[model samples]
Target chain A: MISNKQILLLTSLLIFSAASILFSLLSGSVDITLAEIAGSILSAETNLNSQVLHQIRIPRIQAAFVTGGLLALSGAIMQVLLRNPLADPYILGISGGAAVGALSAILLGASGFWLSNAAFAGALFSIFLVFGIANKFGDWSVTRLLLTGVVVSAGWGAVINILLTTSSTNNVQSMLFWLMGDLSQSRVNLAHYLLLIAGLAGGLLLSRSLNVFIRGELLAVSLGVNVQALRLLLFFSASVFTATAVTIAGSVGFVGLIVPHMLRLLGARDHRFLIPSCILLGGSFLVLADSLARTIVAPQQLPVGVVTAVIGVPAFILILRSTIRK
Target chain B: MATLHIQSLTLEVAKKTLCRDLNLQIQQNESWCLLGRNGAGKTTLLHSLIKQRVIDEGSVLLDGTDIADLKQRELARKIGILFQQGIEALPATVFETVMLGRHPHLQSLLLDNEKDIEIAEQALAVFELDSLKARPVDTLSGGELQRLALALLLAQAPEIFLLDEPSNHLDVAFQIKLLTVLTDKVREASASLIMATHDINLASRFCDNIILLLEGGEALVGKCSDVLTEENLSKAYGCPIQSVHSGEHRLFYPA
Candidate 1:
């Protein structure tokens, strides 16, 4: 049954998300006044402020929010799928594959659309590679999948290092920006929003089975959950989410690894609540972090990934310590 | 009421035969205990009965339906199993853990209804875990965890119960009390139970039938009194066993 406390927490998160998005819209290299924002909304004027708001800030915010939601949602599912609390979206080498693809495209003089396509293709390739190898005998255990993913990720890491060393200096800066997850050039299409919504809905639908699964696989099977089917579904869904997020923002870290843990530590362990909450909280957290990244230096931007790590590590440590003290 | 039938069941692990051509017929309201030493295949047999493991040969049927043909959810509504280990992975409140037993009965994308909540609550009360329902499962002691596991099975309310070492981590007094409550509940519902345990005395006291798995993949199954001879137990355990008459009950002890 849904509890009133969960409802209250979710409502608070929803409000917080809206407020963070508003703050992100308002804060940037060139500060747009509240009056100007209201004017831009109320009157469809093609002024400079309106142009910046519509063309630059709004798309970047949407990109950040959706990417954050996807990453956090994927992290939550990965934790359950691998039955490890430390599991993150990137643990299965999805981002590694995406990075390799994106970097290869960059080397070949591809940008934007083609870069994303390359990243997605590489992610899919890595996904199938891991799935194929781990499930070679048709009965892949969790440890096997984890080992294969980690080993494949290491392989990708080597490839990524090689690419970094071989690329021209002019291209390296942009490549680093993509790898560190820059929102300056990030944009969201309709498909990104759809994938985020689909991921959230799918997570909710499987929330009950996930709840049963965390206890143990044998217990899940005995309780009527088709463990094999559930594992397959989780693997693909989480992989797809990670892939999409990577293609959008090029591997934002910490949001995926910490947002879900923060929620769990706050007592949102129930997947029914955790899934949606991850979307709201993770999205807002990134929107706020990106805002800080944009205005922290003003005119010169910091990568959103750096900002997320800088903020996430200490906040998580504090939460962990307090939880332990309790 | 549901019956479990195992015909010519053969189970193996790592190319070693755990059991061969084992036939069993468990009728309604019957409680059977699997008594075997370590690696004698008690857990393997229970797993095979529930179709959790692939059998080398033969079939397991529930109410005349082959379990292999039934869906996991269908089988779950008719049969429940309490594993040997307690919850060690997830962090959840005791109440939430117990409520997971209702998972099989829930419709897709729907919440647990009031009836399901009531059943879970009643199971918590039965296990004397009402005070700890709000407490996190990871914080509970081993005995409390074991009791919670049993409570979850009660919430499942299946027609057949399969328990592996249900007495593990249970204190002496609570063990007797919980086992008594469990057996009484099974009898009241006219459901059958199959338990795998290492305690010969406990099995002798609680079960109506005995399945003693010996070395060489051979098994002796019959009424408790008929198959629980000193020789059979000694052979099954590969040890010298002695029995003592405790008024109306016969208890086994190693010599």
Candidate 2:
């Protein structure tokens, strides 16, 4: 039954998404008009204004969209994979894994490729560790999985702290800043790579399996779903999506944990709708948050991570309240 | 036509032999009821047939094909079993829970097709669960969920139905309703059904044959009238028993 409410919500989300994209393009530090954005795309543009609009601001906008979309997608998938509403990339220990990797690179004086590499490696390692510990205890119990994650996260956090303390002040500042998250250094090419590979692979492969999964494990298995294989695939896909988000935007939190639940609350539980909705809404939310961070105190940019938390916390609470009321 | 042959099947768990040298054959359209007191291995034997528990010796064959040769999916298509108070992980809708029975028939990525829906709908209608199709299964009453579970088994459309205490947690009306539906399904599909039940009367009224499980892995397998005797019931249940028979129906009760 395709209700009118569903149609209305979908249409409004789309309209809001278009408006948010347009608004993000217009509200950067070096202001560019809507016409200029269009003109920059249309023209064979090499002029200063066109260069700023096309080369710098456009890439940043795209990066924000990709990162935001992925984090939310990961969150939604994690919820179903873990069989808990509170589950997200962070709760599944991906954030801790990525954080460990990013912190290690910073401590080691690594730059460029080493940063993203360390982040990805750390994320995968953490997931594998949690999977191993949980599996070792016989069945894949949810409590055991989360508890193991909590323990590992504590250990990883302690290690990151030790590394930070032992490092020079300059290194510490950069490490701390990355931990807080930033969007200033985002590259279009890297964002494109992360979005295309992780998004397509995770979204397509897992979406169908997720429908089976949401029905519950026994039913999923009875339906010829290989539970073990699917869980591993889900962990790997979500880890990759999460790690890429961290590497690009530097550990933007809560978006990966919150947005998917919002989509579910809005009556889009089917993965086909949920997967895309998370992607679009996540990207849009981050781009808007990033724009506000850049311009809220113009000429003195706040970290996008800080902006996200500030906006995300209140909005998350609002969503939570509305969800509970419903 | 389907035939299940258990030849000298024995099951031992934790160094305790629950059943030993159990030879039985259930052919197409046959219905068998297992009557026993608690801990008599009726449940264990039922579980063994589904491979949920290992058989210590011999083989279980469907149509002379050993169960070991058939993969789980293929075997599932031929046999559907329901456990009492089965696991429910989430609040799955009645339609979705029933649709899960179609899993063995589905391909990797293809969504549920018209045939699958038709089968699910028919199963739902058979158990009078069509109105509750969209309702969350967890919200269902025990009797309703039991009916829904039966609908799920019907959706599988297996040749053999193995039930363990299928009447548990059901009211008298639901119990009678379940027995009637099961009997109707067996008749219409020409399917073999084996149910392990505590109610001797229910078994005598509905079953074509009865297996009386006594203590220490001993059992008497024969017609319902022969197996449901007071002597066997007293020996099996460790209690004085009597039989009441009127017309074609016979019932056993503790004296």
Candidate 3:
């Protein structure tokens, strides 16, 4: 049973997330009022303000929330899977691999959906490569897995540099935009939201097993968990989540590394509560960050990753200090 | 009736031979101690018996069936193990951590039910961990952590127990206290124990059988008195050991 304190904290985060979404909808470079946004939703009108709200802000905000949520959840799983605090969704090189696939597709004259699909394929390929190397001796050790992923990520980094170097200047600009993470370019697709929700539910379902896993391999196996299978599932799940988020917003960093630790500080270490809480906190955090990104510079629009990294670093340090003090 | 039979088992770890052509049978109600020096492969051999480590040759039969054929969950239900060391920290309270012992018995992945809670609380009360129940595992001292791990193993209540130095970090009184619980389990004849340890006195006092594991995968296996001879103990330990007998009690000390 969840404690009263946990319920209170979760409910508060929900309110904050909802407030951020509303804030994102109402406040942007385009001065869309709350009334206009609400009227557009209620009446399905197509005026200028309503058009901006429905056509751009809504999808962008929703997608930002989802991508952020996905990254944070994936990071939490990675930390547990490898039993390393420094682990993040990108540590296994899924994002690096996705970036390679995406940049290569752009180089090959692929645009829009095709590029994203190629990115996912690349992420899947990295997942298989890491697993193959880690499971070579039939022992999927966390240390070995971590080492394999880090090396693969480095390999992907070299490939990405090669692609960037050889590509034309025209493609370089778009490639850089993708590399820095841009949620504004993502279409308002229901599939992304649906996939995010499904993955979160699956992760929460696996939370108890995760709790045992985070404790260590010996305890997990002694408790009858199939550690190898669970490890594989966690790796793939995190990779898939990373693939989707990277496809949507290039590679939003810091959110994955920061948000889950913040939630842990908030006493949401249990995976059942932790995964769901990450969705709320991470989604709200990104929505707020994206709003600041577009408005803080007034129409120039900094990359969402830059905004997240800027805000997330300070917030994480503060939380870390508070946790240490406690 | 529950028996663990090792048939011509060969095991190796890190290019070191742990056991070669090893055959042994341990039945319910028999308490055995695996005595060995460091790197003697006691840990590796115990792991091999539980099928946690891959065997070079032969099979371990649980009751009448090969352990390889048994499902993981089924094996967990039949066997419980305690590691020498625990996670440096866990986010759970002692109550929550110990309650995890109900994991294998749990009908599903949900947290403890009424019965599991009852078992956990009973174990806590028996082990006298009430004061520390609400504390996080990291706050526990060495002895406390060992007791907590032991309590978790007891609450699991499997048919077989394979403990790797379960007494490490435990205070002398608590050591005897926990060992008495294992002795009681032996009396009930519902579970068997195979404990690896360096304490020959404790083994001589409690074990029905003793196995002295020497270097290079050779083991002197027999009853406590038979295998506790000065010659075998000295040879296995690579040290001169003399057995001093006082009344019915036997103690071996360095000569």
lDDT of 2 by residue, B1-255 (tens): 789998888777677666678888998888899988887888788867766556889899988999878766677778777776553735557887787777667544535577888899999998899999888776888778888878888888888988888888788888998789888987799998998999888887778788887777777888876677788889989999997778877767789
Per-model tally of clashing residue pairs: 0, 1, 0
Writing each residue's lDDT as its tens digit, candidate 3 over A96-202 gives 99999999999999988899888888888888898899889976778899999999999999999999999999999888888888887876377878878887888
lDDT of 1 by residue, A118-165 (tens): 999999999999999999998999999999999999999999999999
Angstrom error of the Cα, residue A171, model 2: value is 3.5
- Considering chain A alone, report the TM-score of candidate 1 relative to the true chain A: 0.97
Model 1 chain B is weakest, by summed lDDT over 10 consecutive residues, at: B84-93
Off by over 4 Å in 2: A1-16, A136-143, A165-169, A188-209, A320-326, B7-15, B35-59, B64-71, B86-92, B107-112, B210-223, B238-241
Question: Which has the better lDDT: candidate 2, or candidate 3?
Answer: 3
The full ranking of all candidates by lDDT, starting with the best, is 1, 3, 2
Sort the predicted structures by DockQ, highest score first: 1, 3, 2
The local distance difference test score of model 2 is 0.78
lDDT of 1: 0.91
Candidate 1 positional error at B184, Å:
0.4
List the global CA lDDT of all models. 0.91, 0.78, 0.84
